[model samples]
Target: MQTAGDETVITVYIGLGSNLAEPAMQVRRACEALGQLPESRLLACSSLYSSPPMGPPDQPDYINAVAALETTLSPHDLLAELQAIEQAQGRVRERRWGARTLDLDLLLYGDRQIDDQQLTVPHVGLPERAFVLYPLQEIAPTLVIPGQGPLADLVTRCPENGLQRYE
Candidate 1:
């Protein structure tokens, strides 16, 4: 885990998705867990959504949402926290985009961009993921996606496709 010297709170956006083992419950529980991190506080979470699987078509659709958080932990530490929560939720890395009990991604870390072996901020595939874009729009309509564009524009370009509010 890494920490910055300042220890000031930074706002971050997280994307959560799951397609197996009671996904809705998994997501909600994950949100609850976010508020318990060592130096983090959950600020907001988008409504749950149902979207077609981003990978194999045979699997179940995914339940997804985005969360906003204010944290004093560095980006790496925050990533570690998210992975721990997923592990606690029984996440297994069997196959890429395969069904899972939980999928927690560090979508954006205080307007910063990162690309490395372990993770990528603003998600490398953010531009094309309706599941992410929709929920993000709900919580942060005018937020920008760094190199991509404003969240509002991306949401409009994102097709409704197989997504629907999970209500």
Candidate 2:
């Protein structure tokens, strides 16, 4: 439960994805839930992108997007809220990169670095995932990836093929 000193608001970027049961609708619902948080406001949202699955190759394609938020909640608290939303959407952690109703990942937290068993800020794998980087670049092109360079550069280097921006 890391809190911002003096109750300052922290800006954060979150990545959302889903491949089951009206994914776009689920993502929209999740965004609404974020706005319902007591100390959080949805600041920006990237256009949706459709992409093939990342891990095992036998799943449906996914709809992905990135969102920006200003919040007084700590990183861990935000993560918990996201998990609750996922559970409400019937998400079950059965397999890695498996089909899901909702998948929410915290991409960055105001230039902060966090390394814990349950959560990692500036998400470790975000730089290499087109589903994350492409949409992230739309909303926050100048975003720096902690150890990496600007997000736009990383989006160019990401090898994910068949990523199409949604209409």
Candidate 3:
């Protein structure tokens, strides 16, 4: 963790997804919102990506992206902030991977490995999901996923599975 004056700052990464209410726009707006969070600065955001749904196949395609941040917010606090953003975008927890206006995941928190009920840093699925890995690789090519290996290696092993850069 780096010190921002007296406050401690941690490098964090966020995964973004949407398949409802103009998905692309939702992701773009969400990306902008990440920059507005308190005690945080949006360092970089990957290009928007289009990917097949991970859950029910009947839903519309999803617009996805990854965002990197330098923040002083604690892990739980950051998770709460992400949930708030999702709630504001009309997110409802109806089913796992159900359609939603927005889904913001706290992918990483400064190499910290957390497995609490509320949050999991280096997200549980980060290593396998192409939607998450590809975009993450774009923004942080040199990143090492705490318990997992290098981002580049993971990207090489994961199949595209219809994931593509959004035009």
Candidate 4:
């Protein structure tokens, strides 16, 4: 909701993950690529975490992390940019929650609420996914989950069965 004249920047959070090949390397490359986007600055990046596959458990484990960015792009535009980054990293959407070289999800876009075919603000599953919540908490511990109360509180309620920090 920032205007052009406002000196303050709009802050957004993105969740990144990969499990296809050299997962850690892919995550690192994604972090670097994100910072190169136009009018975007990567403010913080959570430590990489290893987590079991969410769907079709037979797939390889994923390396996940969350990133904070200050950007002037609109939510939709930011999402488009993220999609482009994924594509550049050789992402393929051939299967739902399937293994891939890069997975970039827009976790939150300046506390905005958006529901569209291509994107959902505050990400629909932010409250439930530890992979998203844990890294988010690392950078923005006091951030409220919009409808879900304090993020720390939500994290406590989340099961830790499949999530673990890398270091």
Candidate of highest lDDT: 3
Per-residue lDDT tens digits of candidate 1, residues 109-147?
877889999889889878788889888888888898877
Measured by TM-score, the strongest candidate is 3
Model 4, 62-135: lDDT tens per residue?
A: 99999999988878888889999899889999899989999999988776788889888778888889999988
Error of 3 at 150 (Å): 0.7
lDDT of 4 at 3: 50
My TM-score estimates for the predictions, one after another, are 0.94, 0.93, 0.98, 0.94
TM-score of 3: 0.98
Candidate 3, after superposition: displacement of residue 19 in Å? Answer: 0.4
Angstrom error of the Cα, residue 128, model 2: value is 0.7
Model 2 residue runs over 4 Å out of place are 1-5
Q: Lowest summed lDDT over 10 consecutive residues: which window, candidate 3?
A: 119-128
Under the 3 Å rule for N, CA and C atoms, how many clashes does model 4 have?
A: 0
For candidate 4, the lDDT comes to 0.88
- Model 1 / residue 164 / CA error / Å: 0.3
Per-residue lDDT of model 2, residues 64-88, tens digit only: 9999999998889999988998999
Cand. 2 TM to true fold: 0.93
Ten residues in sequence with the least summed lDDT for candidate 4: 1-10
**Backbone clashes in model 4, listed as residue pairs:** none
lDDT of 4 at 42: 92
After TM-score superposition, the amount by which residue 30's alpha carbon in candidate 3 deviates from its true location, in angstroms, is 0.4
Superposed on all Cα atoms, the candidates' RMSDs to the truth, in angstroms, are: 2.8, 2.5, 0.7, 1.7
What's the lDDT for residue 165 in model 3? 99
